[model samples]
Target: MDCDLICNFKKCRKRLNANAWVSIRKDIFCDDDGSREFNKSTTCPACQTSLSGTYDIIRVDLQQSEKYKTMVLAGQKPETVIDIASRALAFWTYQITQERTYQEFVTNKGKERNIQMEQYYEQILARTAAELTALKTQLAATKKELESVKKKYTEATEQILDKGRQYQKLQMLYDALRRKCITPLTFDMGDAPVHMPNRNPSNFDLTLSTRDSILRRENNVSVSTTVPRSPAEREFLLTPGPTPLPPTISDECPAAQSRFHLHIETPNRAMSRPH
Candidate 1:
């Protein structure tokens, strides 16, 4: 087939050049009869292309079917079409494989993030628990200290109250003793006796002589003597046996007599009074 003629035919039919054809004729001679004959062309009449020489044009036409006509009219170039088809199939297969790999990677990353979040939450819980325990310990210690302080205050208050009671008791005793010491006295002063005589005597006579005798006898007698002396004997020895009276004893001499009387009265009075 001529390439130019095929190109012209494709433009007219709006089809590919590869599918165009042409026809040819064959001549034959018989040896005995010496006759010559020409065979008709069995190739395609429009494209002038030959068949495989196994069948007539009528049989080929019957086998060709509508599928071959559609394939020719689609304008496919043989070599270029093969390369484009192979690349398209390979690219689709690669895209399917990459999609599966990307899905697996995203799942793994999600799991790692979940684990990290769980660990962080656990750490926060542990720290919070420790702090609460420490605070409880401190509170217990403070309570014990407060109880000790309250006990001490109670003891001190009791001691002070006891001392105050003792002081009150002492004060009561002091007041009682003071009342007893200063209580008023109640004696009978009207019955007491007077020592001085009611009237002074003028006589310095026998009564005076007798009192002098008795006083002298009492002075001479021992305190331990058991026997009492007769009054006459006591008078006989104590009187100076009527010796002459001193000039001071005379009644006419008033000054001398007064002096003698005073001396005699004082001695007798002191002796006659209680020992």
Candidate 2:
């Protein structure tokens, strides 16, 4: 009936006899029934560590000592071989337990690291996507601005071309005026005639007078029969039929009546002249 109990602590495998075992208890109150019950735990006496039901103790029977000695025959007795085997068994069990715990610790640490790496990569991808979206918006805005600028430039260019064409037309008109290529038309003044004799063609001067002015200044009439420098001053006489002229009247003067005669200047003689 003699037996040895091994401590469950892998690092502290203290052995105990059957006499060292004790029952630890606590009384708990159940609120539903208002009843009391005893809660029990079996613990190691030397280490004071709580032991699970399956790992509480390792028991070795002293009755099997003779068989262990026959298997390990080195002049060793039965009790010595049993003692060596019990310690060896406890040691190998501790080694296996410690190895399993270390492997679990390593596995949990690797799982945490993988979770952290995955979160970091997700954050980077999200940031990259946001930046790409912003760049696309900016690119679209820039393209629209470029199109607007192009439209404005096109309108301004068309306006400039139109102004250039207008300037060309004005330049042509100015050239025609300078060359005197265009002629003005002529018109008749009245039935009365004035005289201007012994006058130089360069110094000849003419004035526009109404019918009343010519009739009032009959004797002192000064008419100039000078050609116009440019035809812009004359008005055109566009009639449907030929105009008839009155007969020339004879008047005697002391100055030069016999020398030269002044007559009414008609539009026919003016139009018949060469340019």
Candidate 3:
């Protein structure tokens, strides 16, 4: 099936198993292209050799052995010519064998690269699975911690509500006692009425809203607008912290509760006032 004897012409690559035209320069051509080229010029188409009357372009049968084959094998020439022909045949055979081997090597190299690519993909897949498992475990732990914080917040809310109810009941009792002090009820056993002790012993009210309403307010100090021109105004009361700023001037200042509020440039200490 393979065309071992093909036309040597560049444009005519057809098989020439039956008969072919051969030039003296060893150029082979098919019947149709060769006849056209020969008629067009007496010179050889391939090498430009003069082909006048002699059979420079001869027709040969490839299927049958030619008469020239006997002349070449009968050692019609010197031994050096035979050796040169043998060397040329050996070089052509070696080149053909190497070409077949190189094609198989390339094919095997492509298959090896495909296998390596598959192995790299599998490694990436396994790493992704491991990372996903760790993330899922971290998410579960976060959910558990969130539930614990929710339970603690709920318990604290209930405690605050109970304390607020207790404070409201104590405030109602204090208000009733203070009102009783204002209006006296006496026993008429004695001629002179006896005075009861004042119910509000602290003097100032517990709530700041009651005292704030009694005092007249003044404009607040705007730190951004106030520019210090004098040395005394510019002088800052530098205190080592973490202490707080000074308490504002009020009617209830220097009271038992004022010790907790007025703390600028003062060291940390408990109230020295009597309980």
Candidate 4:
């Protein structure tokens, strides 16, 4: 049969050091030496009863025992167990504290760096915005100026074109006037009559000649005189024919003629004219 027991022993040496019968019984019967028998008789150390079945053994170590003793001793105000164990615990505690401190410092520094970077980025964005605004303003002004210049240029070009056209028109008029002024005049007249000087007379005589008489007269050399006859005969023979009038006269007319005659003649001759 199997016997089961539940017991807590601090250490193997602690059980040995108790020196009590009960403690020895607990160590010898419940520890490594304990056993359960079903067909044979296994008696209890104190009561001399058969051991129970299905017993369990529990073991402990010196380190845990010493640790508990030190805890207890420290509570009881003893300094004997204050050794490497306490030092190790203190070292672990200090390490954890230092780690927390470093972590906090690193976190604060990261936050500060992030804040500085944000500020720098904000400044850069502001400067870029200002520059962009300035550029846009300049571009607008330039565009306006370009439009003004283009308008002026168009006006000037139109003015130049107009002047050029006017100059061409004036030049054509001048050329036409010059051609008219420089052209020479030509006259043509057929044979008509020749007048004798000082031929004006109220009456004169004339003779009619036939073709036979003209032939006889051509053969003869004789001077003949005629008597004064009728007015018709005189007018037909010796009357001064009407002087031909000038076909065209200048608009300046009398003044221009007078001046021309004055220049051509002597002063006495010009003064002798009728007023």
Candidate 5:
């Protein structure tokens, strides 16, 4: 009952009452973990101090100690032994109680450290998870913006190509007219609503005149026509009636069953605006 030694490691709950290790610092530990720690560093684990080799720690046998103590006190007088016994018994009793108090202090310190460590790790984890979620949202938004820009780029490219083709066609038409290779397609100035010649005009026979002041003064014709070399031109030559849409004319140009639009160079109107 006098001995109540235990391992100094706060986490270890092993008893060292029978046989144990005692360091110069008076720190006590159990046989198993104590020996292992000593061999690993040859240092005191509790104080974090260097040890002066194996002399710093000593193996103690409590049963042998008590037997030896009794033997040494045996040879003395009964009264002398009795008086020394009282003081020695009290010393050992208080020493054992002090060791228990120190164990409780170490255990409490270990618990507080564990709690603080858990709190710190939880805060770090929550912060990291939030950052990960924000990054994912940003990536999704970036992808959407990229797709929108790509769609607008494709539409602009198509519009540019359409305009280029229209310009080339106008250039070729102008060269042919200036050379006098094309004959004028006649129109009725009388009550007839400007008859488009019934026959499909050949390349040399197709002609266009403008409604603008300059062309009006030069030629006696008032109405202008855009005669394409394609079959769509003959469709216009048909007498006024219901007409079907042509594949050649697209969303770029608007057309009605009896009328179509053309881009002609003039002082005011370079191209017709879409309705």
Candidate 6:
């Protein structure tokens, strides 16, 4: 029911079994079966051109039309030059389409990445500006607070110095008063005996000494007239010490107290003795 057909075109002249030929009757190309109905058309496999009535159709034994059988019997058949060219053109077209698609994908992806990077940079700049503004505000507040603290410190320092000056003035006045109180008293017992006939007698020599000297009456005799040398000594001059009480004044009269108060209790001996 099938035949072998060859293209009549001298430039092509490719041969193929009827089953492998194009069929115009059904508008379907080659099929696996070799059911060759009459009036079926075919094209040259190399040129893809119709060779319908122009080609010769030779009746072929079914067993001989089998491709594997033909190959085994005839070894290998070489493809026509046009067939090789056709395949090369098809492969080239496919490669071109695939390359164009890949290029489009890469270009679109690059554009999207660039847009995202620009947006990210803008966001970063905005955040930085806000943080910078906040820092400036904080710095200004800190400066204000520092100035306030400095003012308070200056006022406090001035007050402390003023109080210290007042304390020093008071201390100097107290020392002056104590010095005046200790000024020795002078007496003139002209041509009279310095001694008195009594159970207790006056210890004063009745002789004139230095005007600024101190006079301490002890055992009815004049004692030392030493004066304070330093401000510390003057301050401590009135402080009571662990010295023995005068026998004549056992009730006790501290030197510092007597100097500052201007009041000294007369010794018991002086009070009891007759003048």
Best by lDDT: 5
- TM-score versus the correct structure, for each prediction: 0.32, 0.39, 0.33, 0.38, 0.40, 0.36
Ordered from best to worst lDDT, the candidate numbers read 5, 3, 6, 2, 4, 1
Better of 1 and 4 by TM-score: 4
**Per-residue lDDT value at 127 in model 3:** 96
lDDT of 4 by residue, 1-275 (tens): 11222222223222222212122124232334333321244454433555544442223332356667656656543354566457545644553564466558989999999999999999999999999999999999999999999999999999999999878766665655445333332111112122334333422233555544544563343223233443433333334687444433356565333322212344354445444
For model 3, give the RMSD to the true fold: 21.3
Candidate rank order under TM-score = 5, 2, 4, 6, 3, 1
Candidate 2 Cα outliers beyond 4 Å, as residue runs: 1-73, 77-83, 181-208, 211-275
lDDT of 1 at 133: 94
TM-score of 2: 0.39
| Winner by TM-score | 5
Q: Any runs in candidate 5 off by more than 4 Å, and if so which?
A: 1-71, 75-93, 176-275
> Which regions of candidate 6 are displaced past 4 Å?
1-90, 181-275
Worst 10 residues of 3 by lDDT: 262-271
Winner on TM-score (1 vs 5): 5
At residue 105, give the lDDT of candidate 5.
86
lDDT of each: 0.46, 0.49, 0.59, 0.48, 0.62, 0.50
Query: Model 3, range 54-84, lDDT digits (tens) per residue?
Result: 7667877667667766664575566877786
lDDT tens readout by residue for model 5, 117-211? 99999899899989999999998999898999899999998989988877776665556454333344222122223333432323224246543
RMSD of each: 36.2, 17.0, 21.3, 29.3, 18.6, 17.3
| Per-candidate count of clashing residue pairs (backbone under 3 Å) | 7, 1, 0, 11, 0, 3
Candidate 1 C-alpha RMSD relative to the actual structure: 36.2
- What's the true lDDT of residue 71 in model 6? 59
Query: 63-169, model 1: which lDDT tens digit per residue?
Result: 35688867743677877677767764554444344445555777889889889988998898899899889999999999999999899999998999988876765
| CA displacement after TM-score superposition, residue 57 of candidate 3 (Å) | 21
